[model samples]
Target: MDSGKARATPSFSAVRTKRAFEAVTDQIRTQLANGLLRQGDRLPAERELAEQFGLSRNTVREGLRALEVAGLVELKKGATGGAFIRRGQAEVVVSSFSDLYRLGAIRAEHLTEGRLIVGTAVTRLACQRATLEDIDLLQENVDDSAGSDAQTALSVNLDFHRLLARATSNPVLIVLTDALIGVQRELLKIYEPASQIDVIASRRRLLTHLRSRDEVAAVSEMEQHLRLLQSHYLEEDFRYRRRVAAEAKAAGEAASDEA
Candidate 1:
């Protein structure tokens, strides 16, 4: 076998440390970093890995479980099943953001402000880099959003942001946009949406700027729209908190009267 291909084998040395599982994971991580192991490549059987690492099968299994949780590998069962290298996924980032929001570590202000920053940059870059097809797609998204129910409008509006990020041709921006939007979706569940007609109109203006390749106008339009959205969100969040407080007060009064 070619030396390059041979490197794909479970050629890890016997680990002499007490924390053998860490060593097992370290070796596998190194291989992945070196490109010796790639997506869809399966590791050797548990028995083989244990032998190579000079550790128990259980210890090797523990390392594999850790890899699975880290999103570095996927474990499968039955015939034709083993630990396989996984391609990078944006969902991991999305999930992490969602968790932070749920834990109250990420507030509405943080999400909305981040969106403004990212959305403006995405618009500027997309205006410079977008193809004719990208513009058409964005127009189509806006058209679909119009005349839809509130729920459908919300979905399509979020999709527009995703499409704009995609137009930038920057994967990092796309991933960050997805993560921010994912968290915003969760935040939206707690508050009412702003005016859909206003959103649609702003989108039309944004598309016009994009079609003209006017980065300055496109970015300005996006920032203005996002600021309006931020104000609307903050106002709605205030109302939601007040509503909850009122309901709690009413419940307490009712309980005191009964007592």
Candidate 2:
């Protein structure tokens, strides 16, 4: 119990408990990432996972619920009932984003800031590690944005970001990119359709940055591009909302005075 340097580190019992839950999550995540657990792969029964992990069935259920919420697994009832892996989990990302947006836990500005930081980081990483094919994929994604609606362009633009993250050959980076891109998708829903010329111009600049393989320049360009977007779209949303609230308050006050 001494407060000095000789005291042993606190026992990791609590840490271990938390890690157990994470262990369960990681095991399933690993299977999915490695292709061992494909979409529609039926999870082992709760009893089976509990026995394997040396935990109670209730703990296993809790782990399953967490995965379900994370869009990794789905549970169904009836003759064919159990947890099934989802093949395409984009919906999970969308749902999670919608929840945050609805709760105001995530704001348009926050999404723009995340894109500025993470997008620039990914671009820099791509400059170092991108393969020729990766570059082509990114260019194609950029090209697709040229003619698409804002929502479609946003999706393809995120595809480019995710591709860049994958080109870094870092699984952690890819997952982080996906999380931020998911939020970005939500923020895009509020913007008007992007102009064809503007989309193409942005993509062309981005591709040029990638091809040059100048990490500093690529990162700098990405940050500037996102900053402009924040000013154009996200800041406008803030201004519009404030204006509406001010008008509503003025109308209510005038009505009360007339009464």
Candidate 3:
């Protein structure tokens, strides 16, 4: 045991140089992001990939495995399925937020606050810079949301916010808004499945303000809308905790009676 421990410590340091497989992985990732590789695009065969990268087959396999874990690619077992780049990654990002919520790392209130601040800021920019096309894109989302189910409404609402983020012309703001939107969508689904909020009307009001070139009104409307959504989550959490506390009290009384 003492000999094994001594050998492991040195072995870890000795292999500190860049791994061949990791280099290949980076190259593949860059290609994927650069449109050289796209969704449903089959990668070169394993043997060909190894030759092209000047790497061993084992190294290529390892890189593919890493990509699979990252949700960037899928590995199919049947002959029909071989490493396709994943499509519609919004679900993956949404699932990532689920894990954080499960761990209590982030909560509904935090996401709600993030949405309020970011939404208001983005609205101001959108009001100033929205093109005719931008307004049409947002109106399209609202039109789709009208009379749709909760799931469909949530998707369209997210699209509306994303359009607003794009109008800002800031890549950083767009990405950050997307992550915050993911969190807000998850919270809405969990806390307010059928909670009526007049979503279509609210969205229409916001767009109207923006179209009128009213930055102040746009920001005000956004903050109010996000706060309304926040209230739903807050009430849901309160009700859930109250229900749990009541159940515990009932259980305690039953136990005392049995004793």
Candidate 4:
């Protein structure tokens, strides 16, 4: 290749084979994906897994850690606790969405818009299909959030939204809502110190709409709530713009003075 010039063609070939731990992890993950192992199902003990895979105990441990981090398995101590398939999949979705945001593959606006659309659907369904039990649980979540700090309040708020998703009785909706709200919760952490919006009143109104089974009112209320959320990130944008402008002005002044 010429110096400082790109190659005419780059070689394309398969990557290296999976490491021992990766192979072990892949086997277990495949079972989970295939539904051969249900949630809460315990895997063989670490020693047994090592023997089964013909890998060392350390390798088996590494694979188990990978599964735990991937939200596929839970490892507990004591005689009763081993590697159990994860019961809740919300974290898995949350982890993926968080990664996308961190990688700049998705933006705040994209997620916010997603929440608006998906959240409205969940709210409408909750209004139409929520049983009395669902209503009561949502009421509990809202009530719990009333006196909490910003972080706890954020969790409570998402719980209410998750309830709305569940009231829809659609698993796909549940996962989608979980991922969106999880990202929102994380972003809110950055602004939590300055966040002062009293969510209780807004949430109470939404609950009332749901309880009344007023689909239109429920959706309208959700849209309004989402607009309120937009203000938080919009304020962030304004602050960031102001900081950049100040820095640019400083740089320009310095350059002119030097000249």
Query: Which candidate ranks first by lDDT, i.e. highest?
Result: 1
Cα lDDT tens digits for candidate 2, 112-201:
777788777777888899998998998878767776776677667668778888899876677767877777666666555345566567
What lDDT would each prediction earn against the true structure? 0.90, 0.73, 0.75, 0.78
Q: What is the lDDT of residue 142 in candidate 3?
A: 86
Clash pairs, candidate 2, are none
- Residue 194 shift from truth in candidate 2, angstroms: 5.7
For candidate 3, give the lDDT. Answer: 0.75
Model 4: per-residue Cα lDDT over 1-259, one tens digit each = 1244342321112213458888877788767666567677778888877777877789889989999998888999998988888886777888899888778676667877898889888888778789999999988888788878877876777788888899999888999998887777666655442343546777888888888888898899889888777766767756765888999999999999999
Candidates 1 and 2: which is better by TM-score? 1
Which digits, one per residue and each the tens of the lDDT, describe model 3 over residues 1-259?
1222222111001112259777766777767665566676677677777777776788779989998877888888777767777764554555676668677788877777777888888999989998989998988888888868877877777788999999888766687788787776666655654343566778899989978998998898888888887787778877877888999999999999999
Error of 2 at 10 (Å): 27
The model with the greater TM-score, 1 or 4, is 1
Candidate 1 TM-score, C-alpha based: 0.87
Per-residue lDDT over 1-259 for candidate 1, one digit per residue giving the tens place of the 0 to 100 score: 1234355354788999888888989999999888778777888899999999999999999999998987888999999899998877888888889999999898888999999999999998999999999999999999999968889999999999999999999999999999999998998898888899899999999998998888899999999999999999989878888999999999999999999
Task: Kindly report which residue stretches of model 1 are placed more than 4 angstroms away from their true locations once superposed.
Answer: 1-10, 15-23, 248-259
Which pairs of residues collide in candidate 1? none
TM of each candidate vs. truth: 0.87, 0.65, 0.65, 0.70
